[model samples]
Target: MDASSAGEGFTVALASGETVTTRQILLATGMVDELPETVGVRERWGTGVHHCPYCHGWELRDGHIGILAPGGEPFAELRVTLLRGWSSNLTLLTDGSASLDRPARQRLEALGARIDERRLRAYEDGPDGGYRVCFEDGEELPVAGLFVAPSQHQRSGLAETLGCGLDTAEPNPAPFVVIDSTSGETTVSGVYAAGDLTGPAQSVILAAAGGARAAYFMNHALAAADAQAALTAAGLPAGSDGD
Candidate 1:
C-alpha cells in the first residue's frame, strides 16, 4: 500500500489498485519484532519465548529463568537486573556476545545470578517441562522460561513516507514515530500515531489507551472541520464553535 499527502488531507493507494482519500489518518501500524538467530527462538515465540519482564515474569516466578543477552544491546545489563526480581535462579546467557564490566558483574553476583557466556545452539522443550537451553559446546541447561530483548521496527514504512517525525533519542533501542503525548498527533497535522509505532512499551493495554486518546482528538478535529465547511458553504463566517 502507498500513502502520500494530497492537498490538505492524504491519499492511500491500496494493494488492490484502489485510491482512497481521507481528511485525517490514524496510524496504528504497530511494529515488527526481530528475534535472534537461534533455531527454536522463532518457533517458540509467545508460547515459550517472551520479551517483557512485567508481562511474563510472574508466571515463571521462583523457577529457573534464563535471559538471552545478545551482543551490543545497550540495555542488556538492565534486563538482567530487572529479571532478577522474578526468580532467584536466574542465568545470564551472553552467548559469547558481550563482556560484562566489573560493576555489572558485581551487580549480578549481588543478585545471586549465574552468568553463562557460552554461545547458544538452540532452544527445545525439556523432557519434563520448560525450555532446554542448548549451547554450542555440547551442553544444555533447563529453565522454566527464557527472556529475550528483540529489536523492533515499524511494520509499515508509510509513517516515514508520510513525513512523520521519529524519536531517535537514547533508551529507545529503536526509533519510534514521534507523536504528541496527549493527542497522539504526528508531526504531520492530519496524521496521528499510536501503539508500538509511537513508543517502546509493547503492552496491549497501553496501545489501546493511546488509540482511544488519538481517536478522541481526531473526532473533535473532524467535527470542527466539517462544521466550518458547512458554514462557509452557507456564506456565513465560521466562529470558534464552527457556527
Candidate 2:
C-alpha cells in the first residue's frame, strides 16, 4: 500500500490504485540489517553468522564463539560483554576500529575474553561447519559461530514518506522511526509504529506483542472518537458520553 502524506488522517493507496482513508494506522514495516560485505557471510547468515546473542547463544553455547566487532565505541564493548557469558572461549575482533577504554578493556580481560584489534579480511567455512575469520595480517580465528551487531535500516521507507519522525538507534548510528515508548505513536498524529522499526528489541515474539498493543491503543482511540462524535450529535459535551 502506498502511504499518502497530503491528508488530515492516514491514507493508503492499494495495488488497484484506490486510496483508502483511515482514522488511525499501525506501521509494522520492520527493519533490514546492513551486514558486512564479506564472503560466506550472506550465504551462511542464519547458520554461522547471526545477529542476536540472546536468541542464538544457548544453541551455540560452549562452542568457540567469535564476536565480529565492527561498530564504533561502547557498542563493541557492550556486544563483547554480552557474548562472553554465552561462551568461555570468547574472542572479540575489533575490526581495527573498536577501541575499548582502559576500564572496559580491563573488565573484558577480567572476564577471560580476548581482544584482537585486527582488521577483518573475509570469512571462510572451516571443518565440520565451523568458521575461520581471516584477518588482514593473515591470522585466522576458528569459531563455531559469529555474532555481529549490524547497522539496521527500515525495510520500507513508507514511514519517512508519510512524514514520520525518526530517532537514532543508540550505540550505533542507525536511525529508526520515532515512536512513543509506551504507545508507539509516531510524531505525526494518527500514525503509529511498532516492531523493529521502532527500536532494537527486535524479535518475533516482541514484535507480535508490540503489534497487539498498537492495535489495542488504536482501537481505543477510535472508540473514544466515535463516542465523542455521537455525544456532539446529541448536543452534549465530549466527556458526557460516559453517562
Candidate 3:
C-alpha cells in the first residue's frame, strides 16, 4: 500500500493498476511551513531566518532581531513577547496584517521593540553578512536575525482522507491521529502515532519517550498474542482460565 501522505489511512496503488485495500494505517507525517517568497528568507532558514524560538533563540541571544508579522492565524502575542528576552534589539514588522490588541500593543511597546508598519517586499544579504529586509515602501532594515510565523500545513493527507480527527478544542486544528497517552493506540485498531504529528511542544526527549511508550505497548501486545496462541494449541483456554 502506498500510504505515503500523512494522516490516518492507507493508499494502495495497485501494481496491475486495478484495485487495492488497506485495513488500518497511522499517519505520523509532520507539518511544515512554506516560507514567504522572499529571497534571503529561504537561504537563511537555519542560519538567520527561523521560526521556533525554543529551537533557535538561544544561539541568537543579544543579537539584533527582526520579526515578520501579519500572520494568517491568530496566536498569542506572547509568542513575540517571549522573544524579547532573547534580544533587546528586536523589531516587529506588520506587513499589512491586522492590528494588535491594546494589551498586546502595550506589551510590545514595553519590550522596547519597534513596530514597522511597512510591507516587506524582499530580503537580501546585508553588508555585515546578516540580512537586509527591504520594504515595499523602499525602506530597508538590517538585522542579525529574522523570525516569521509561517502558516502550518499538515504533511499527511492520508490521515485527513481517513477522517482522523484533530484536537480542535486546543489551539491549531489540523487533523492528527488520536493515541492513548500510555499505549499510543489510535482509534483504528493496531494503528499508532508518535512525535510531532501528535501535537506541538514536543522536544527530542519527548519524541523519544513517545516512541519508547509505543514500542513498549506493541511488545506487550505481541507477547499477549503469542501466549494466547500457545494456550489454544495446547487445547486450553486462550486467556487466564482460573490458573
Candidate 4:
C-alpha cells in the first residue's frame, strides 16, 4: 500500500488503488537494520550476527564474542560494557575506522574487553553457521556470536512520503522521524509517530508503550473535534469560542 500524505487531511493509498482519508495519521512503520556489507555478515545475520547484545549474549556466553561496528563512526561504549556480563572474551572491533574516543576506549579496556581496531577483511561462516572475522592484518578471531550496531532507518518509505521530519542518534548519522515527547505528534500537523522509528529505546515493550501513548492523545483529539462538529451540525452554538 502507498503511504499517507498531508493536505486537508491524511490520505493513505491502499493496494487496490482506493484511498482512505482521515483526520490523523500515525507513522508506526518502525525501523530497519542497515547491516554492514561484510560478506558473511549478511548471510549469517539472523543466525549469528545480531545488533542487540542482550538478545543473543547468553547463548554465546563463555565463548568468544565480537562487537562489530562501522569504521570511523562514533558508537556507544555502553554496548561493549553490557556484553562484558555475558562473556569474559569480548573484542570491540572498530572495522578499520577510527571512531572510538580515548575515554570510551579506556573504559572498555578497563572492563577487560579487548579493543580490535583492525579493518575487517570479511566475515566467513563456520560449518556450524558461526563466524570467523577476518581482518586486513590476516588475524582471525573465532567467535560464536557477533554483536553489532549497524545503522538503522525507518522500515518503510511511508514516513518520507508523509513529509515528516526525522532525528538520529550517535553512531548513525541518518535522521529518523521526529515526534512529540508527550503526545508523539510529528512535525506535520495531524500526523504522529512512535516506536523505534521515533527514538532509540527499542524493544517490544517500548514499542507498545509508545503506540499506546500516541493512541491516547489521538483519540482525545478526535473525540473533541467530532463533538464540536456534531454540535454545529445540530445548529447549536458549539459552546462559543471563548468558553
**Candidates' C-alpha lDDT:** 0.87, 0.80, 0.69, 0.78
**Cα error, candidate 4, residue 240 (Å):** 13
Q: Tens-digit lDDT track for model 2 on 1-243?
A: 688755657678887989988777889988899887766688878889998987899988889888776634456666767777778898877778656677888887887778888888888899887889998999888999988788778898889888899886355457788887777789988899888888888789998988888887778777888898898899988784241
Checking candidate 4 for backbone clashes, the offending pairs are 72-97, 166-176, 167-176
TM-score of 1: 0.93
lDDT by residue (1-243, candidate 1, tens digit) is 989999999999999999999989999999899998888999999868989998898988998988887652556667777887888898888888566777877877787778788899999998766889999999999989888888888899999999999988988877899998988999999999999899888799999999999999999898888889999999999879631
How do the candidates rank by lDDT, highest first? Answer: 1, 2, 4, 3
lDDT of 3 by residue, 1-243 (tens): 234323433455655675544433434566776776766688888787888788888977898888876632254255567788888888787766646776776777787877777777887788867778888888888888888776666676655555555565556544456678888766655566777777665467777777778777766766776798898899988775231
Each candidate's TM vs. the true structure? 0.93, 0.86, 0.79, 0.80
Q: Please name the candidate that would achieve the greatest TM-score relative to the true structure.
A: 1
CA RMSD of all predictions: 2.0, 2.8, 4.5, 3.7
The collision pairs in model 3 are: 6-156, 6-159, 7-27, 7-159, 8-159
Candidate 3 off by > 4 Å? 1-26, 71-73, 202-205, 237-243
Clashes of each: 0, 0, 5, 3
Instruction: Tell me, by lDDT, which candidate is best.
Output: 1
Model 4, range 73-146, lDDT digits (tens) per residue?
Answer: 45546667778888888887777755667886777789887877788889887657567899888988888988
